[model samples]
Target chain A: MAQEFIQWLSHPGLNHFLIISGILFSFGIFAVLTRRNAILVLMGIELILNAANINFIAFSRYGTGTLDGQVIAIFVIILAAAEAAIALAIVLNIYQNFNTVNVDELNQLRD
Target chain B: MDLFTIVFYFLAIITLGAGAVVVFSRNIIHAAFALLFAFFGVAGLYVLLMADFIAITQLMIYVGGILVLVLFGVMLTSQVLDVQMKSGTIQTFPAVLVVSALAGTLVGIFWSTPWKTTAAAPMEVTAAKIGEMLLTSYLLPFEIASVVLLAALIGAALIARREKNA
Candidate 1:
């Protein structure tokens, strides 16, 4: 039993990572849906991005034939930083105009 | 299970649980804390994947920098006490429905696909190789991303600094 389990552990496949990424992605979507704060929404978005990053790095590590996945992960990180900067700016602007970052109150477009 | 598997499972559980709390918590500060845990978990995952450089970057950037920024935003904007913040109504039913559907679709796609490892020979490359690629073949995109960050910083400063005497 020990030997069998050890062999399974060293399989070097991406399935475990994929499953974890999928769960993280789901949790992120849940956060995006239920959270009322704009900043929390941005956190959710970051979680989603991190999930994608995990997938990229996993594929890069396991497949290793091409560097494309690792390259993509680098781009993803840069894009995520850019995204966070713009998002925070927008959040700040929203707070300035309304003095609140609660999503439910921004209902001018809800008619 | 070996050490790697043990660590992977532990980190994975922490990440998923913390992520759930991030969405489910009513107080924004608590949510931010949970997000920090989730980010730390991802960095752990990076270590498991043997991307030590990327793992360190994830820890520094996501947990240290971005999360701090988020917590600052939360503190700057909120007036309620922690107890008051804890009672805010988060719309539930619609959110649950949408999230469940999304999870189902994603898991379905993941399960249906037979993920085959590409038959290409493994490259014995390092983070140095990646750095070289970024500077050479990927230089154009790298430069563009830097420009975008510069623009974002300027824009953020411009939008955030209100005219005080106006």
Candidate 2:
């Protein structure tokens, strides 16, 4: 059993990549849920996007063996860039208008 | 272990450890810097997976372009940079519980499923193939991505510019 597990670790299969992506996704969610700063939240979103990208690349390499997944990943990266740009712009705007970047404290909109 | 396996393990550690720092670090600057390693590690993983073109693109667009913009955002929004920009966490316990459940479920699904895999050999060169596809089948998306980037550029500039009279 021990040698089998060691061999599996060395092989680094699809499940390995998927598990790592899962862990990354969990960390991203934790950051999004726990961080009050809007910029930090945006960072969390970036992490989530990256986790998904890893899965795409891994699947392309292992499962499909086509460039389709990589192509989709490229588009996803482009979207993430645009997202980070626009989201940060919005965060800066919030800071300018409200003098704070805390998502929780930006509650005047609710009222 | 063979060299490839060792390299894979190294890249995975770098990726996950740096990602951890990015999420858990209190100082914003530290987190941002740590993210550099995370991105680099991901790029290395792409290379190991034989997505050479995507790996280079990741390095250029992420490590070069996006990271620089993110640093600019950090500096521009914070006003003062001398003090530690300590961003605090909230609802930590509940977040832990929720994230644990989510991760467990995902890993369970990943392990239990019988994923279909092909034995196609990795290409020696992916850049030319990717380029051909981009100009051929992915032509519309290629153009659309450029347009989206242009719009984002204009919108970001408009929003972030200093309004002297507002």
Candidate 3:
């Protein structure tokens, strides 16, 4: 079993990409859930986007020999760029109003 | 053992390690900088997957554009290097528990699923095909994405601009 696992590791395949993307996605979730900084949360979202991109490219390369995945990945990248721009602008607005980027401290909407 | 596998593992480690730093780093500036490496590693992975156009796009757009904007935001904001630079976490235990469970499930699924695999082909130029598809089959989404980007640009400017009454 140990030798088989090592051999699997040595051959980087579709499953390898999938596993890596899964880990990245989980880390992104953890960051979004736990981090108090709004910017950090945005970073987490980027990570998640990247994880999805990896999956798309991997499947396109290993499963289907087409350019559809690459095209979609380009669109995803563009969307991620736009999202980061809007999110950073919003975060800056929040800082201007509340003087802090900590999500926990932005409880003014609370009763 | 092989060079291809070696490069892939190296890039993966860099990506994941930098990603971890981006998540758990206390200093926001450090995290922002660490994100640079993560993006680079991801781009490298894209190249290894034979998506050269996507890889270059990832490097240029992400490393050149978005990351610089993020760094600028960090620098322009008030007290970025002071005590407030420390990014704290809330409900760490519960978050870890949930994330770990989700990760386990995903890994199990990946291992069990019999994915469709084809013989590895030599890297070919994909820019032309991608461009052709964008203009033909994906024309609607392509145009919509541009519209969305325009809206985001205007929205960002509107929101970040200083109010006159203030």
The residue-level lDDT of candidate 1 at B131 comes to 88
Instruction: State the lDDT at B45 in candidate 1.
Output: 87
Q: What is the DockQ of each candidate?
A: 0.49, 0.72, 0.79
Cα deviation at A28, candidate 1, in Å, is 1.1
- List the pairs of residues colliding in candidate 1: none
**Model 3 residue A59 lDDT score:** 92
Q: Give the per-residue lDDT digits (tens) of candidate 3, residues A5-38.
A: 9988899999999998999899899999999888
Provide chain B's TM-score, model 3.
Answer: 0.94
Query: What value does DockQ give for candidate 2?
Result: 0.72
List all candidate RMSDs to the true structure. 3.5, 1.8, 1.7
Tens digit of lDDT per residue, candidate 2, span B30-143? 888988998998899888889999899899888888888788778777756457488888999999999999989998998779899777474679888888899999999999
Which segments of candidate 3 are over 4 A away from where they belong?
A109-111, B162-166
Cα interface RMSD of each candidate: 2.5, 1.3, 1.2
Instruction: Per model, state how many residue pairs clash.
Output: 0, 0, 0
Off by over 4 Å in 2: A109-111, B79-84, B162-165
Please tell me the interface RMSD, in Å, for model 2. 1.3
Error of 1 at B1 (Å): 1.2
| TM-score-superior candidate, 1 or 2 | 2
Please tell me the TM-score of chain B in candidate 2 relative to the true structure's chain B.
0.93
